[model samples]
Every structure is written in C-alpha cells, then in structure tokens.
Target: MATFIPPGSSNDGADIDLLGKELGLSSGQLREQLNALYARLRLLLTTDELGAWRNESLALFRFSASSSAKATEEYFRVAPRVLDILPPHLFLKWVKRGKALCHDSPGIAAAYFRASPQALATLPERQFNVWLAMGPGLYKRNSESMELAAHFLDAAPALLQVLNLAQLERLLLFLNRLTETDCSLAIRCLDSAYRVFHALEDDERSLFLSIALALVRLKPMASVTFFKQGIDSLAGVTSTQRLRFLTLLAKIAAYNSRHALSFLTDCSHALSGMDRNLHPRLINQCETVLAISAIAGIEFLNNSPAVLASIGPAGLERWYREGLRILRKDEKDGLAYFRLEFPEDGTLERLLVRVELDHVRGVLLMYGEALGGSEIEIRSSDSLADWSLGTIDPGTPATDGTTIFLPSSIDRFDSAEENFTWYKVAVTHQSGHIEFGTFNFCFESKAALFSDSRQLLSADGHGLSDMDRFLGLFDDRRLAADIFSLVEDVRIDYLVQHRYAGIRSGYRFIVQESVWKRPSPVYLPLREAFLEIVIRFSLNGELPFVPEALRGPTDTALRLLQQLRSPEARVEDSAEVAIRLYDLASIIPNTRLPQRDWNAGGSEQARSNRVDTSYRTSDGGDVTIEPGAEVPYQAPTDVDFRGNSNPDMLNIQPTPKDGSDRGTLSPLSSDIGEVQLNSMMQGENLQSGQYTADL
Candidate 1:
C-alpha cells in the first residue's frame, strides 16, 4: 500500500481525515470514534450477511462533511444507530435528505440526523421517506418553523403510539398548510400534537387527523383550536358515535370549512345533554341542512338539543322542515331560525304543539314574582336534577328555595293552551313552596295543629340537616321520607288551591289526570294500597273505595293529612303528620290484597288480608304475616305536578361565596347549624355538589 494505507482506506481514510479536521480531532481520536461506529455497524451487517455494504454505507458519511462541525458530528454520532435499522440504500437516501436540509438550515440538519434513529425505528421505509421529505419543506414554508420541525422529528416514537404513519403524514401536511396563515400556532400544534393525539383512542386518531387537515386547508386559523378544544369536543361524544361525528365534521368542512370545527364542538356538546339515541337522527337532520347552507347547518346543530328539548323529540322533524323551508326561501332568516332567533311572526316557533319554557319563561317569571313578592328566577327542572346528588325526578317541577324550576316543555295535552296551563300549574305549585315556606323547617319548632313526634325519637347524631335529623328518627328512612314528601305536597297544593283561584281549575285538571294514572289500589299490596289511597286523596280529595278491614287505618291517615290544610300549617306540621302516617303504615302487613272482584263491591279474602295482623320495625324487626307472601314495600308512582322533594339534600352547604356577580349567595344560617338553605332556595352552586346551568 505505497504508504501502508489500510484496505479501501484510500477513500475512507481521506474522508475520516477530513471529518477529523472538521471535528477538531486528530486522526487517531477520529479513528477511535469511527472504529466504534464501524464495529456497531459490522455486527448488524454480519448478522444479516450483508457485510459488503459496510464500506458503501461508510462512504455516505462524506455527505455531511460540508455541513457545520456540529452537524457533521451529529451525523456520525447517530450514523450507526440509524443504519442499524435502515438498509444501506435507505441510509444513503436518508443521508442525502439530511444533506438537502443542511443547505437551508444546518441546525435543522443536525436535529434531523440526531432524531433519525427514532423516526426510522418508529415508521416503515415508505413513511420514513415521506417524513424525511417534510423537514426541508417545513423550514422553507416559514423560516421560523425549523425549530418546530426539529421537535416533530424528535417526537416520532411517542407520536407513533397514537397515530399511524398515514395520520402523521396528514398532520404534517396540515401543519405545513397552517404555517402560511399563523406560523406560531402551527408550531404550537406540532409541539402539542403528541400529547393531544395520545388522549384519543387508536381508531379516532386518524379521523381526527383528517379533520385537522381539512380545517387547516379551508380555515387555517381554527387549526390551533382544533388541537385544543377539539379534543375536549371529542370527549362529549361517545366512542361509537365519534366516527359519524368526525365524518360529519369533514362533510361540513367541504362546504363551509370555516365553521367545521364549531359544528364539531357545538354538536358534541349538544349530544352530551341529550339522549344518545338521538345522535344519529340529529346527524341526519344537520346533514339535511348542510346540503342547503353550511353556516345554517352548523347553527342548526349548535342549538339542536335546545330545540329538541323545547319542542320535544316529536317536534324535531317539524322544526327541521320549517327551517328548511326558510332556508330555501331566504338563507338569512333560515340562519336565524336555526339559531332560534327567528322573528316573533316566524312559523318555526309555531311548528310544535307544545309550550316551550323559553316562550313562557317571562310570563311565569312575572307570575312567580307576583306570588312570591320577590325576584324569582324560572329554570328547567332538568337543571337542578343535573346538579343534584340525590335523584331528582325528571319531567317534574321543583324549587331550590329562590328559583321555580319547571319542565322544559309541557305537552301532556294536545293544544298549546293546555300545555301552557300545565306550565302555569307547575309554576304556581313551585312558587307556593317559596311563598308558603316548604323549606323553612325548624326541628325545634312545634306543629301548628298535630302533636310533634320528632322529639320522642332518638337522635342518631349523623344528621347534617334538620330534615335529615327529623327523618333519621324512624327505622325506615325511605318510608319516613316518602311520608314527609306526601304531607308537604299536600300542604303546598292546599295553599296553592286557595291562594291562586285562577289556577284552581288547571290544578284540579292535573290532579284528576294524575288520579286517572294512579294504579288501582285493588291490585296493590295492603301497605302500599294504604299509601296510594292517601296520595289519591291528597291529589283531588276524592278517596277510592277501600276494603272494609283497612278503612279505619286509611281514615286515620287521611285525617292526619287533613291537618296540613290549616293556614297556619308549617313544614314542621308536615313532619308531624308524617310520623303518624308512618306509624299507621308500619302496622299493616305488606301482603298483596286478595283480588277484589271489581264487579262485586267486596271480597271476604281481601277484607281478611287487609286487617292489621303485624308490625315491622324500621330496624329490620320481624313481623307476623298474613296468609299471602309479604312483598317488598314499594313507593307509590310519582305525581306529575308535585315534581320531586329532597329536603335532606338542601341541608348540604353551598360553594364558598366569592365577591362576584355570578349571583352567588351567602350560606343561609340555620338555627342548629350554618346550612346553605338560601343557596338551595336561590338555585346557586352547592359545596357538596356542583351545578352547571348549561346542562
């Protein structure tokens, strides 16, 4: 070797000598590093029996010689790690790509070479080449984007966990498109892509990437929010529904790409508050509007739940058809209809044969103000049910102290007048609770007429509320609660009937309707039949026929209920009567009544079973049985207009008050403790629970 040059070292020794000078190292030190890299590559080549490519692969190192000293060092430092996974031709291709990048950004070239092992390790050869091609293009799109491109390359391994190669490519293209409008937002999206994409299911990542791409192409400004709020929007949609939701987003993107993300966000929010079964039908409805105008379609989707809630599900088609007619006639008003801001004369508001709270909230608000003589807000009962820790029955009206909550719509009868009457009935009953003080229970106070039994019962000391302590006296807390609710409703209805004469007819009609819906006592168990009779009697004051054996106890229960009609009756009086009713119900056996032949007025078997044979303690005491098997105690069916009562829940405290204008109130101090009675009355946020008005 003329000068003792190593084999094939004529070219290799010169390149190593050149790289050594560029790296500020002597030939020996450079050779030492080269030997280590060569040894690592040698093992890979020998294992695959492709040792001949080692020299060819080493020849590619010269490609980085013209780059910065740091770039060349990074190139050699990661050469073996990259080549260990890439074949010789692919290595040549990667080095050439880095060489191309170095011409524009030497720092990016170093980052690319340093991050190549991870990128190639995570992606297939085809996808790796595609990703490699993005580096120089990204830097060229915006000079400031080179740093984010470097981060994107370095984050490949983690990104691959959530996104496949196709998705990654689409994301890169989206970022590239986004760079033209807002380079900083594009950079932010790339930096956060791994974390954002990681939150989605494997199947959702690709679809979301397509959506991102579509948004960036049409409305580049939304790309940043698509990465932020877009993930949150997906959370509102179920896994099974996300595919259709994203597909609809893409369809909207094609027509009105500017509002595509909004449709996605708003529709997902609407779906969460509504029934899951309605999602498909709702999508079809939005798509129908999407065919006419993209903005109107999105507006339609944004307010769909409110529309469905206002008009009921039965009215969705009519509402949609009305909007479509307007859209076909005039896009501007059609947009207004979908936004629910249509003019007073618009037919869209008249399409449903229901009474929506929105149309009647003001009138009822005035009515509540007049009756309660204070500022009373009117809200949907569903709002309180959503915030309540206890079960707040749906399709009912309730009061949280200050506000009167009613159903979103009342369509129990066909005409709007009947439905509006139903609303008035609800408003009046709930307002009566505030007007007559249903929540003003004082455990230490005496009843207006009935004897107080609460003091005689032992205190459990676990009661955080006066109602809780009062109900805690009985062995069957649920039974005691049911009795108390029944008595309080009676008192409220009695006062409502006398105080508001205009609503008496509607109230009577509702009570009669409830009576018609009541289960026949003839088929009920003896104990449940007694409670059902009391409920019916309280509704319209018309008691059904009772078996002779149960007539005495039933009369006693009704007499205790009648005590609430006194004008001086208080919530404590309702509690007192509940104890008497509870004692009366406890003595009766829970056996099914012997079937009464409706044709005959009486049956001996029914009369025999109804006789008070035994009593069970609330603390799981045993009892004597009738001839029939003892059935579990069942609460009576809910009275529609009475709504629901959770006095025990009212004892919980409100969220700590802040000096803000969110209408937050100071905690209402109770005689025994600092309970948040006023907050509950006002429908503000609670400490033990949370309230979201949007739901």
Candidate 2:
C-alpha cells in the first residue's frame, strides 16, 4: 500500500481552525462549508493528502473573490487533487498567480480558476503563469482566441512525464522570450509547443528550447519561423544519437548565447536532408568537437551526414575523432581545419581515403542472401535509438528473423577490404541464426547430441519457451550467453567460410584480425588471460601466446570449444562448453594488473606491454594504450546466432510453425541513394525564407 501523506496539514480539526480565523466565519458555519468541500474531494485524495492541502487551501482564501466560500467549495474540489500532485508552496504560489491572472479578463475568470490547478500541475508555477498572463494582454489588443489562450495548459498534463518541471519552465520561457513583441507569433508557438514536445525526445526538446532561448536573446524573429519548423528537422536523426547531438548544439548556445541560435538553426537546416538509416554507423562522435568551439561542432554537423552517407559511420568517426585531437591542441587551427577555412586541414584529401558505403553494401547483401538463401536487406540498427531512450552499445546487432541489422560503419579496421570483411562476418553470423533453428528449442525433449541437459529444469514445468529452459541450466546466464555466442558464432563462421569459397579471404581476414588486434595475453591475470585465449581459439587461432601458468586451463577450455565446431554439434554441445567455461572462469580471480603480487609478471611493465592497443569503441574508433599500462579484457558484443543473449528470457516465444514467417523477407537492395542535389535544394529553400509566413 502506498503512503498518501499530503503536504503540510496535521489533521481535519487544524484545517477548520485555520479557515475560521482567515475567513471570519463562525466555527459552525466554517465546519459546514469545509464539510461540503471534503465530500467532493474524498474521491481524489486520501485523508493524509487533505491534511497537506490545508495551508495551500488557506492561502487561496487570501485572494479577494466575491463569492469566496462558494467558489472555494466548488473549485477547491478539483484543487484537492492538486494537493496530491504538487508541493504545498508551489500550489499556494499557483493559486495566487491564477488570482492575479483573473483580474486581466473578468469574463472568463471563473473558467481560469477552474482550470488553473491542473495547468499548474503540468508545468512549473512560474512558466504556467508566464504564458497565461500573455492571453489577456493579447485580448486587449483584439487578438483572436484570447479567451481560449489558456488552452495551452491542457497540453501540460501529457508533457509532465516527458519533460520534467525544470525543462517545462525553460520551454515556456523560450516561447515567451521569442514571442514577447508580437502577440500573434506568441499565440502560434503556444499552440504548436505541445505537438512539438510530443514528437521529440526529452533531450531533443531541450536542444530546441535552448537554441530558442539563445535566439530570442540575440535577435527577435521576424516571425517564429525556426520555432515552427525546427521539430520537423529532427525526423532524420536516430533517437539513440539525438540527445548527444542536441546537447552539443546546446553547448554552442552556451558558448556564445547571441549568435549560436542562428548558427545551430543553419546547421540543422543542412541535417534535414540525409538518408539517416543506411551507410551507416549511427554514431554521434562529432559532438565532442562542439566543446572546442561552436564553429567546429556546427561545421561537422553540416558536413558529417553526407560524409557519413558516403563512407558510412566508420570513416566519419575517424575523421571526427582525429579532428578532435587537433581541436584539443590548438583551438584556432582545429577550428580553421574543420570549417575548411584553411587548406592544410587536409579535410578534402582525407575524405579521398574513406571507404564508401557503396563499396561494401553489395558484398554484404550477397553474403547474407547466400546464407539465408532469401533476399535479406542489411538494415542499419539505428532504430534501436527510438526503441530505448537509454544508452546501448552501437556494436550490438539483432535480427527480427528477416532483416539482419548491422552497424552502418565498418571503420574498425584501417584497410577498406578488412572493413568490408568485418561487415561480411557480422551479416553472415546473423543470417546463420535464421538459417539454423536456434529459436526452436524444446524444453523437455532429450538433446539430439548431448545427454542429461533436460534435468536442469523442474520435472513438472510451467509453460516456458525452449530458449528459457535451455539457458536455465546455467547459474551465471550472462557469462553463459557470451560463451554460447562465441561458440555458436564460430560454428556459423566455419559454415559460411566452407560454403562460400568466394568470401573465404574476407572471412579469414576478420578472424585473423580478431587475433592480431586483440590485447596481448601477457598483460592479463591468470583467468582473464585464459578467457582471452578461449576467444582467440574460437576465432581459429591455435593457442596463440598463452602464458605458461594458464596454459592448463586454456587447454581445457580449448578441448570443449573445439567440440562445438563439429558438423554434428547441437545447442547442447554449446551449452556444455558454456558451463565448463563458466566453472573455469569462476575459479580464475578477476584480478586487475596493479593488484599486489600480480601473476602476469613480477614487474608491472612486463604485463603492461601486452596492454590492448586496439581498444574497441562504440563509435567504430579505438583507444590507444599508453606505455606501461595493462588494459583490462573487455568483451565485444557479438551477434548471438542462437537468440540466447537477450535478457528477457521468460518472454521468449516459440518460432512460427510455418517457415514463411521464420525470417523477415527483404527485397534485393539496402542501398543508401544520396546525391548532393538534395542538400543543395534544402539549402536554397532555407535561404529563401520559404518557411516564414505572415501571421
């Protein structure tokens, strides 16, 4: 049961006493009127909430209304719910403002009083009044719908969850700030704000508001042109990347409050015309450059999407991260380079080396189509941003059983061929999941290849998916899922390389790249070192550089993993390997290199030489390891071909009986068709003031 303690009142008797003193009512008459209010209010509030309502209720009596008692009895009915919703101070402040607003338009004063509590609850007190106070001022100037001006408050309730109280205040303040001189423009923004806020993520909402705030302070709009069209401009951005992209734009406004509003608006105008879903690493790396200067951030914003459309997320990320390093060293030089303000920045020449999305999109489409033997569109998993509002690794990919969603950029490797091969590995591994029936596990049936696995679940089980029963065998499911992924992916890679002789070079290159690029094993502790070896072996490396102390455990893990590569191996075989690896990893201490008496070597530098130089990052960039520092073994998020890596194990459903819906069908292409003409057209439209209209 939830405790419904409302703010500020001790009991019902204290309320009667306070109201009697304030209203000059005799004790008996006060009791009668207060009782009338209570009867109507009990449906909305608990006894405790009514207690908190006392002080704010008493404060509303401070307003000099003619029929104070009757109006309080009627309007205060809804106001009780406000007590349940707001702090006592905020509620009192809101009522006082609404009383002040009433004096402006007496004709609709009663309706304003009736609606004020809910409105104030939607936005913080100050902003709700800021927008509300404008209506009557407009009415005096003969503005239409002045009486309906407060309808903007109706949008408040829906927005409270999306934008917290502080953002709501800033949002309204920005509206008032922009429309202050013109009542007509102010009314348009007030009406459109709800729809705009509804369509945007909270971070995107703040960027629009912050830019508006900056712009209003700089130059008043000839009209609220940008305000009206800004939200529509963001439809091209991935929800995952929107907040960071928006936040960096906000920093530009913060750096130079006056001109950045126009600057960011101009940049957004350019961003509005791209094919955001393809070629693509859906990365937001260039945002860091914003801290260097607004010009740097804005310049990247203008140029990056098209560059990304051409090279994909990988090449763009490399360009941005490298530019940021320069930006950090000298602000002016970095700024000049990114803006193409100087020739030495090598901006044009570096782009020449970039691997275009067109180069690999076809190769991957063929790799996937060959494996699934169905036309599969290799979709960019950029939509994950919209699905979740929180942080997710961009490297992780998922299949809806039809489209194999892969990261857009393959810039993890330096050479274009190596990057293309990386794409082939990801697409083939995911297609393998659909090619094989990993999702079609049966809970109670005996294993086709391994014995006694069914005993892991209860004898009389409730309805659970086969995926659940299979994973239930392990205590540490995350570790089990990871091991299963490594083993299953290895199995799929073998099959892909075996069947497609054409992609053999690409497939072998990625596997060898995984080993060559991995952190040297000498830097890790005994157990982590062993696990790293396990990963290396799964990539088809033969016990490469295993330390003498861990060679025993590494060999044990190798024996189990090798069995999983057999043609007759089943999901049970992968599960057994996962269990053994879990047991072995459990005993291996999770010791950091700096720990006293480290086992890697007596001296720290010996262990540190093996530090991972090629650190995998979300933006398809790598972190360089400084000398004499040990890099911890961080696992990569591989595509789980078995569909066992998802955390929602209980909800896993059985695969469809009909093969028709087993995997999502895609037509022949996933190409990103972009041309410079599209941006040029939008640019011309923006400069023409085409969005502005007479109010």
Best by TM-score: 1
> Each model's number of backbone clashes?
7, 9
Candidate 1 residues 490-528, lDDT tens each? Answer: 998888777655567778777787787677788788888
Best by lDDT: 1
Deviating ranges (above 4 Å) for candidate 1:
1-23, 26-33, 40-68, 126-128, 141-143, 201-207, 217-219, 265-277, 308-312, 315-318, 321-334, 341-695
Q: What is the alpha-carbon lDDT of model 2 when measured against the actual structure?
A: 0.54
Candidate 2 error regions (>4 Å): 1-108, 117-162, 175-180, 202-208, 222-226, 255-284, 308-413, 416-485, 488-695
TM values, all candidates: 0.45, 0.44
Instruction: Give per-residue lDDT, candidate 2, residue 251.
Output: 61
Candidate 1 Cα deviation (angstroms), residue 670: 59
lDDT of 2 at 650: 25
